[model samples]
Target: MSRFTDFFVRNKKKLLIGIGGFASVIMIGFVVFLLNRERILKYAVAKAIQKVENKYPAKLKIGNARFLDLNTVLVTDIALLPNDRPKLMQIDTVEATVSFRSLFLGRMVFKQFDMAQGAITAFKQDSVDNFSFLYKKQAAGETVDSTAKKTSNYGTLLNRLIETAFENVPDGVNFRNLAVLFKNDGRTINMNLPTMLVEDGEINARMTITTEALTNTMYVKGVIDPDNYLLAAKFYGDNQSKSIEVPYIQQKFGATMRFDTLSLSITNKVYKNNQLTISGESSAYGLVLNHPKIADENVTVQNGAMKYVLTLGDHYYALEPESEVRINKAIFYPEATYETRPKRKIGIKINSPDIPANDLFASLPPGLFDTFQGVQATGTFKYRMNFFVDMAQVDSLKFDSDLDASPDFNITQFGPVDLRKLNQEFTHTVYEKDKVVRTFQVGPSNPNFTPYNQIPNHLKYAILTAEDPRFLTHKGFHEGAFRHSLITNIKENSFVRGGSTVSMQLVKNAFLTRKKTITRKVEEALIVWIIENLRLTNKERMFEVYLNIIEWGPNVYGIREAARFYFSKEPSQLTLEESLFLASIVPKPKQYRTYFDAYGGLRAYPRYFFKLISGNMLKRGLISPSQAASVSTYVNLSGRAGSFIIPKPDTTHVQLMDTLQLAPIDLLDF
Candidate 1:
């Protein structure tokens, strides 16, 4: 023990000297590394470029790279070129300052960034594109398991994406002459930012966008907090007279949209407990849109705004119920949710508090509601709708919509077409493919016009059974038929059936054009609801107008004309079989001759329709079993329609009673 202690004391001084020398060596090496860090960063960047080139069918070039300061890097003459294609991107110079600590943590947080003379070009010709290499290619022979029960953290993924995007947006920036160009199939779009600056979290930018139709200069001014993912921006054209035209839509979708000014704000973005919540507001002024499917003319809105709260979780995305949408003086709350797990389902709800009738009328888009353009009204109305659908069980979908008016609600003055005209004698016009085909008077004053009481009960019941079974009892919309139609359309992925009730048909024939547009359909529905709920006309009068105005045969415009055109008799004098035959041809009035054989006898398809209609009428107690049993599918087209038939042998003489038990009633038979 004594010897060991003596030896330790003797070497203690030497040991201390050795340890100090080793520490000094490490400190000196670290200092040397810090001094040459720029070279190391450049090497790392070169290696990254090499990796990218090897993986993608593209080449990246950097003319010069060096460190400007401890954390700032300056790169010049950078270009990326895809093989056998035009250059994808080019930059004259780029300077960026990244957080040193973040770099060590495998993240690049840009504190400041500056770029000058940059251009990005995306081109496509035929089946080839310059930017295709940027997309990661799926491995060959790999198959996706669509039925796999996999749940994704949508909130987490979206939050990470947003954070990553915002991390690259520097707090201070100076950008100049950045142009982005896209060309495809002879169509070109160019957007150039002449100058953009971000100083102290305030942004100012000037941009010019050019397309085939127009060129516009736009200004963007905003305040941003990139770290917190908050931004408020205002984008406007050079002047109030100019509007920013949304690119691509006009060419790609055959729709045009433009706005004079748009304001957007992202007030908050928060992710907590695997849930991401975002709140924002968007408003636009002087917005105009035109689409053939929506309307025939441009629809213009003076002001529109929305305040929204959006939430995302593991398997669902939702717009909170607190979100509010405003149009002029009207306001509504909307809520929507989409879920991918535990059965894919989507639900939407919208409700509006009582809004003044005048405000509602005034808020309508100018060209969209042309019929109600100068309409004046008083009192108030509220609207609410709830819609839900499970993709797995679409048949169980739920849709409920309502619009309720106050007791005193009234239209003080009429617009283009007076709603009260149907109560008295009025002129009705028929349109085919947007062309005026026939114009006729729809009243007792017209010789061929048949009054409601003059129409045969058999014809009315047959038509009701064929077209809308619940037209007398329900509102303008038949929910069951609509649900069935929706299910069928969803299954077919096409609009094969329209659940048009008699009331809707009446409204369309009376006040709307037969343009087959979404706007027209919506207008027809609204008008039907208004007429029915407001009692503008009685059910008898509406149905009477429908029977009179609806086309029956070539140029046939009324029940009286139809009876003479097909059966050579008055509507009140038509028999049950003739009524059934007339109802069967109502859907294809122009093609009525197709239902009959060359011998003027009803074909098999029309025979099937006859049995279906009569069976339904029997079930509804509209006709006695004896009447249904006595019905025949045979028809002797003794009028003008008989001239169009051929002389083929009658091969469709099956008894209506025998087929009545075999044929299933289809509400859409009409």
Candidate 2:
């Protein structure tokens, strides 16, 4: 170090003068560079774009890419997809400067900024839409209640996020609020939202998304009365005066309970299928439940069927014919346990080729065919639906297929056909199409299609008290119910035990074949499990469907038809005596004729079976002793005489042949 200093001292004055001149020039050059910062920035931006294109292999369509004075981006355009239209995006125009502190300290610090108009648009699937800027909440009332806010974790976290992002925002990125929208009117939709924060996976967005897929989107872009949405309930709620469109709204329900303690309620509203909905402005932490009122509301009578509207709080439920039935739609919600709703009586319409009457008759249980005195046909036929809502209401009835030409009738070949005799019995087998497939006809008491919704409530309670007491509280497949049935089976050593709920009855009746394979039973169990989560409770439509489509003899389908055939009277007129007869024979239709000697037998069921089922009903508070005693008596089971042949009118004729033709049956139970 000493040697070097001695050498430098010899030329210290010359070195000092020379170094001073160089230092002055360098400082002067730097000052000039800062003054012309805009030019340098432009050059840098151009180079950066070129590098970007070279660095990544892509064919991105870019438009109006710019760099203004002092790192300002005046205008920009980026196209993510191919379209016939052009996309424009603009940030507020302004003059700004780069922060020298950031440049030297490796920290981002900007200053001097301004903004103007900015908009973002994205189109997909023949729709147009746009996104806009946001405004902060400015309300009068208090939400946190001061004391709670002091100890709120979420409140504190929100505070931190706002503080961190704005620290280095600077004036360069300033902009006025954004304005964006989307509009479509016919079979199309366009929508957009700009400047959104998508934290985690859920979105807390306040924007509009409109589409032209329905009748109208303009009229449907706001709040609506929730009750009108239900298909069945709409008819009774003054639909004639006002009908509205709803394209972007849905309600979500939540509960914290289990069997006997099951509790549920709805929460914040969201767009359809939950696009980007948030909590109510003043929603509480927990939601309160509004259970549906069935049969308790008004019902409409139309087209020979009763139309009952069921509402859960203000939301609409299903629309179905009047009859005895069950749905698991939050079925046991009142019980507050883990239970699921099954696919039941409700169904969606489909557009498919009609099934030949002959083809449908070919699909029946092995021996069940030809067993009925005037029975007919074989094989399976089905229709294809365009869309569907496969809920409990839909699950109850089996959707075989629309009937084609009847037994020997053809629609295309029009001949002399008597319209007045459509349902009348004929000597020659006649096929009919479009006739409602069911087990019985409904009068005020029967209420076939829209029978009073109240009827099912009463009937279900009765049936439940008469059948399974635990139906309301258990999941679809009740192990306890199963165990009891097994014990009974062991005692009697017979397959006369069934712990299946009304839901299970619908399943086995509608879908599964008559085979007693474990695999098939397993499938039934699984479907029942699904029903527990997805269906409603008891329904009148369900029972009506069960009775109408069920066979009593050859072609004897519904309770209406059966009532007329057996008693020569309307179903509504059949007293308790006749109703019990119907219930007794249902469990074993094939054996009905044999056991009753043609339904001339046990008006009541087997000893243990009746007690077990009836006891369950009693425990559930479904029936009175009078009702039980009335159901226990037999109207005409006076002797062991299997003379249960369907009654025919004097005008009705039956053609007998070695190979007699009969109507197909839907004996859908084991």
Candidate 3:
């Protein structure tokens, strides 16, 4: 018994050591499994992506992927391109997690998709964007059964994976340090999102944007269900000292603009059925506008406020369209509406009661009112306007407006600055190709400022139709035209088109330089407003000035000069086709100069341009269909007296007086 006990005690140590060795080996195996886990996960993900690509029309690539936890992966340098694009998104890092239950069920059910340091660039091709792919399309030549087959296997698995990742309502989706860029043509809009979070269909984002006019930060919180077309959100933005400073504004616009404060806020609440209620408020204070050429001049807005509420349904928003805007307590109501049904129609209205003009213009900086330095101004300025447009026949738009001042204001400075004298013969400063400003006068007493009756009806009609159909109607601005220009510019991603009014052009030609500066544009607009509102000159006078002073060709100024240069005819002798041809080259006279062959004959393209002008003239009722049909596309610039003459009534002997009801003559005629 004693010997057996000693043997057992001695062997007990060896037995315990053996058991410990086995445990250590098992522990080593487990460590090896953990070490290779990332590789296994990567392979699995790659395989799944391959399966997805086999059925769907997308490309997926991964630079490197590693397991963060048992069910989480940290993917680096991932790129997902779709629709045969180069790369739709380039993600620096993405941390994705799968639910334990989903992993166990052999499904890629994602619980989270947190992305960081990424850039998403979108391209707009023919108005179809990357997001447009979400709307499923039926495959061509596919029967119902075939279509069903298309979604089976890999497609079904991939769709299930996607549904599980998104429709399951993830706990959180975080996007950090992301930039979204949209490019159409030469224009680029960038938005930097510092932090964005999506939780239970709710989105919270804070972004910064820099544009030509302003740099601002926006905060947004919203709930959007694209599937149901439901959206609710709150937005807030502010631009104070951080706005584009005066120096930057001057650099960009060639004018200086300053605003003490600008703030905007909006709220949107939408019901489940897509009925949306929107409310917004905007305010700006201490606005200042200045142009270098207009010495000591300042246009100021001490304060401005706007508030509105709109309710939108499936068809239209802002049905009631109750809104108010006040600039220094000068209230105005501006509304536009759209109706869909039997015939689509749009209506716009702007109205305001008589407001004290001095109250608004008085805020200008000292010496800013030097133009009216010796003028005694008194009386309220009453404004009202109405416009209707048929969407189908946009050319047949109707507009009516009245801007009147009660009890005329006297201005003596206007006489010495007679705009008509300048129009007749003024300093024409040409920005030469060599970057030199060359100046010259039209003549000692140019006859180009022809009387209204001497101006050919066809020429008048052409200018009105091509340059500004609403020239005689609008006060100084055409909101609809400007909107169209802005939209087209944005869509094309470049400012290749313009919607400048004839009055604006005149102001630019007479008072401002053609430097393509934003400041110049602002100055032009301001002067046009003053001339129109203060009744500095009548519409006919403005039109006459514009026709006489505007550039027509290389060193050529005025319709009379253009007529002599192109056709060797007086302005009154221009035929309908010649008038249309002249209007077509107004915007690009220098470029179109080459359109004439070495023999001084118009090219085919120029003839085509004339035809285009004819189309617009016909639509605007400036030229009858018969007149348009009679117009010839060819233009012979041989400069022979009767080479290209097409006889028309010569109304030059008629009274050189306007028959259309003229607004009361200027209070102080120049």
Q: Could you estimate the TM-score for every candidate?
A: 0.81, 0.29, 0.42
lDDT per residue (tens digit) for residues 1-670 in model 2: 9988987999899899999999999888678756755455545445544443343222224344344644444434433221233342443433345554343333324454443444544333343322110112213231212133222122233223333343434533333444443333333334333332222211222233445432221111112222221101111101332222234322222211111111111222223321222221111111122212211111211111111222111112222222111111101011011112342223333332344434333322222222211223232223332222224233222322221233342222111322112122222222234233333332344433233332234333434444444555655555445544544444454765666666566555544444454444654654454344334324334344444444554455555555655666665566554554555455544445532323333322332234444444555455577765655534553222225443332221221210011100111110
Model 3: residues >4 Å from true position, as ranges?
1-282, 286-301, 319-321, 336-348, 363-376, 386-401, 407-426, 431-437, 442-505, 513-548, 558-584, 593-670
Candidate that beats the other on TM-score, 2 or 3, i.e. the better one: 3
> What Cα-based lDDT does every candidate model obtain?
0.82, 0.36, 0.63
TM-score of 1: 0.81
User: Can you write out model 1's per-residue Cα lDDT over 210-291, one digit (the tens) per residue?
Assistant: 8888887999999999867898999998865478888889778999999999999988899999999999999999999999
* Clash-forming residue pairs, model 3: 253-518, 253-519
CA-RMSD of model 3: 16.5
User: Which stretches in model 1 have alpha-carbon errors above 4 Å?
Assistant: 1-62, 65-74, 80-88, 95-110, 123-160, 183-187, 270-278, 310-320, 337-346, 647-670
Q: What is the lDDT of candidate 3?
A: 0.63
Give the CA lDDT, 0 to 100, for residue 7 in model 3: 90
Best TM-score among the predictions, by candidate number: 1
> Tens-digit lDDT track for model 3 on 196-287?
89878788988886555556676767774534433455555554333323435565557777666555555433333444555666776776
RMSD of each: 7.5, 23.8, 16.5
Q: How many steric clashes does model 2 contain?
A: 95
Question: Which ten-residue region of model 2 has the weakest summed lDDT?
Answer: 328-337
For residue 627, model 3's alpha carbon misses the true position, in angstroms, by 15
